[model samples]
Target: MSDAVRKIIHIDMDAFYASVEQRDDPSLRGRPVVVAWRGARSVVCAASYEARKFGVRSAMPAVRAERLCPDAVFVPPDFVRYKAVSRQVREIFLRHTDLVEPLSLDEAYLDATAPKIESPSATATAQAIRAQIREETRLTASAGVAPNKFIAKIASDWNKPDGLFVVKPAQVEAFLTPLPVGKIPGVGKVMQGKLQALGIATVGDLRAHPLEELQARFGSFGAALYRRARGIDERPVQPDQPVQQISAEDTFERDLPLGEFDDAIRRLAEKTWLSTRKTERVGRTVVLKLKTAQFRILTRSHTPETPPASLQEFTEIALALRERVDLPPSTRYRLVGVGLGNFRERDEVVEQAGVFGE
Candidate 1:
């Protein structure tokens, strides 16, 4: 890393899945929309800004989200469609910079230190990207421009849903000072509580602590925190991140017996299946994970000589694995997850099988 500052732009789509639905279906516009499978065991995938005002949020249980906003329209997730739109956005990103790191289908970080498209500044580059996203996709995006990845990510959300913000290199220290410690990446509620116990509520308060003390308190994470408090992140944006594993899990509102897990298993299998389709690689294993009411965790997996050819085969394999569980029939489960792992590129998997397959 050089002392010279880098220009990074973080672009985050606004309520991506829900907004896509609204864009394609005019009636969904201006109406609160929750994108998710409609079931007690289902979770919200994305909520439109209109839905957010009513307290609906992504990953929240669908049952609870319904209670929060009874009038919200619930639509099942369509990852295939979302992934198509995502590819369009990715094309738009590559037009400006090759150094684009896609964090997900809806958000990415672009290293515009030297953009392919000549721009007056990184701020202009971010603005141009946002505008292009709107013009091309008919969806909105928020952008943050800064010297580093962490700051850029945080700034992106400062003014969200079709907004743009910039933090100059000289302004980094002051920009982080008054910010809440929780605003720093990875500082979740548990970490915030730990920091508050030490009277560290803001970045300024955290900065007052000595590095040795912080390291002693938090180990490697604490040392990272010390640097974050000083706005000294040096991490680079990573592009073309390979697929390792894809899974979806849910914690039931109430524990269920193993016999009653069929529906949940099927739903989670579909989610993992849809997610895997977005990647070029093939997942070769089926994994069934269970957490007992007593908090005991168990996992079962099988890697077929060939990857499960269809969702039906994958879901059936997951259900069959449940029969392998040796727990007492009386035992109840609090959580269940379905996954596809042992990811290998399509060509690699095909070559190993001695059969040409997609």
Candidate 2:
């Protein structure tokens, strides 16, 4: 193992939801598929490659997707099945290394420096993982192998469905040079515009900019930009990271006054409670989040001496927290959210007194 370098692999499922739908139904294979609920207000959860050719995309309104691909087949998302498949994929990853960081149900970063499997190299490990996923799930995945996470993430996308790309440490700088600044993580459209204004259109241009000048121009983010331009990122793939919060939110088709939020809050609370039940940790704080029609965000939270004992109790607490909102009675809200925070692992709470002798 090289002391100064780490081997990271990013694996991403191709058109996850749409692919799953295609796999389960023979009739849907080789067809443009859009995964989303059928409703005027519904947005696409995923779009198959066939749909992409017709300009359909994830998060696009379903009606627009229908316009883009009139022959497209629409399938609602099946999160329960998705979660099961995700667990199967995670099990496969754990067979390689425990150092797996999941970004979503269909994508993860795996530190393959010391894989459990006796692979000849990180590239080989990535190949084997991709092969296993195909053999086991009848699904395809794209992989990127690199010296670090960020580059691995970018490399993973260089190839489309069922492809692999590798970036050796020596090739990092060369690979990043001509890449647009927007390709760098965290440099979104707005940031790209700001950098473009300064004649920093590519990683090479960003590299040439003086560190002091970048600092002055972009504040702390400037330092990050400088490092990224040089193909440097030190983040590690951490598994079982602590949960800070769990929340569920929704945007309504039409904004409604505060008095009409009861049903929304209850629905969000039920969603949040379902999510919390997936973990052994218990959250002591119940939070109510609201976004006004004008886009102003407000939150109210309460921490009781004990965590809510049941989903009903959780919903009750979330509903009660709504009364704490001091916004004008006539204020209309476009979004409502329910959340749980200040979590403690069940075992941690059980052993606290013994460990501290308290």
Candidate 3:
């Protein structure tokens, strides 16, 4: 594709999981709702705007959300119901464009440059989609329209909760200039602090630094930052993107010391390995993820010269990865995840493995 203009829209549902709970139960309406299982190890899947007022947020520990909002109703996630609703919303998108890239159950990116429906502009297409979603699902959605994916994603959140924001091609630089570097995707708290330490606070400040200097400081990610600072993103919106990895994770009923997690790791590794069998792609890397009782996350990954050949090999590899955890033995963990990643086509794996006569 050339440097031709593109029409992109990012649609995000308003408090999706919590909103679904409120919509389904009359008692939950107008009340603070936290969507999560009730347990010491449970985490919030979503929080209603009402609950958000009390500082409750998604991914926060359920116990903490309770402390934040004493009266909030806690509901476990019903993925079946959420999937049903998500399908309806996706059907609506299909009517407008086949270039629909779903980000999750409640969000997607639509390329409306050549839409199925005749719209005067991308902004109009976004309004139509949002309206149809509200009419069919009785749920509100926010949208952002821009010349590219990253800008569209950011614009969609500018005026959130049933709002729409637009960033025209001519205005992308101006739109980004005064925005905080943290507002750029992938620039999280740690990255933002590092950038600010260098007196790079806003997007303009990031643009001021030479690319060589940025790469020296932050490596390849710095190159990404350089492009984003200039409001340039060339990634195409890909629909039906392939599965990148397969994994299973669980939170412990009680926090357990590192040595006590071997059984958990074996079970999760078996589960993950079985999932990978369903795909033709082979996974070469085994990842072990641990979440401390205090909520810090740590992961250890190893890519062997060849993919694990059987369930036994996969399990042993996952078990051995546990030794890489340098946390104090007394440091209990609340969660464990086993994953197979770095997936490659079977033919490619075989071709690479042939080089070592394996």
Candidate 4:
């Protein structure tokens, strides 16, 4: 929206986990693959493009995915290897620009207003990045280049799986006008339904609504909708954002009572602990999250005088926090999660302790 423009590129890996599995095993190159743990309660982490044709998708129950594609090869996720590959891809990004913001192991946003390499334009930089990824990792990536982060993120998906799309500054309005409202980030199914009820199905339709009316109807999000509908995003690409929290959650096939949640809690805690190990900071607060069958949500947290010293200590604290739940005894929960927060670097923790004369 500002006359001063910024160049942002969004890069996303193609079926990351499933692609990694296929890349490592030549026998799986052209076949449908589903990455997931082995259990009735497990959910799909990633589904290859081939499996997607059979209606299998990430987060779907493994049992349902199996039913959808009985012949699909099922493999467990190897996050350690995935992380290593992610680091390799990140190094490729750094060669072009330092303003790289990793969204996850498979996707990132890069500000290429001034690239390190002598490239004529952002599009060229993106092409080189993708080519390097394929040559080095044998993996494909999709890239989108636009004047701003919001539009760039949408452009990235236009040409997926080893493709590139670009949106110039002058083309922003024309590019956004006919897009469905659901195409905008944060406008999920529920929001889409609400907009549909108001006869607003596309970005053009949303533009017809007055700002005041949109604000009155959808609260603060209405303002965001108004700007995004016009392809006006002013957010900058940040590279040094700190980790605020680390967590892992799972949904059960059937609701289970609180008394039957011990195993779930332990598993989630272990998963959360694994994630924390990837960072340099340690978490001092342990949190337990739950969702009842009736859709009610609850959270309980504990922050001890000292941060958890080990995975066993972190798990114990999370499990003990479960007893703090005050819901009805008969309430059945459909989801459970464990989290660690209030993170601090080891050096900072030591400095604080010394300052407090502890």
Highest lDDT: which candidate? 1
- Give per-residue CA lDDT, model 2, range 71-94, as digits (tens): 999997777788788888889999
* lDDT per residue (tens digit) for residues 170-210 in model 4: 99999999999999887877678889999999999999999
Tens digits of lDDT, candidate 3, 218-263: 8999899999999889889898775687897878878999988786
Q: How many clashes (backbone N, Cα, C below 3 Å) per candidate?
A: 0, 0, 0, 0
Off by over 4 Å in 1: 1-4, 246-280, 285-340, 346-358
Cα lDDT, model 3, residue 70: 99
Clashing pairs in 2: none
Cα displacement (Å) at residue 23, model 1: 0.6
Where does candidate 1 clash, by residue pair? none
**Candidate 1 structure quality by residue, lDDT tens digits, 13-55:** 9999999999999999999999987876667789999999989
List the RMSD of every prediction in angstroms: 4.8, 6.7, 8.4, 5.2
Judge candidate 2 at residue 207 and give its lDDT: 99
TM-score of each: 0.79, 0.74, 0.75, 0.78
Mark the 10 consecutive residues where model 4 has the least summed lDDT. Answer: 273-282
* Regions of model 3 farther than 4 Å from truth: 246-286, 289-320, 324-358
Local distance difference test, each candidate: 0.89, 0.86, 0.88, 0.88
Clashing pairs in 4: none
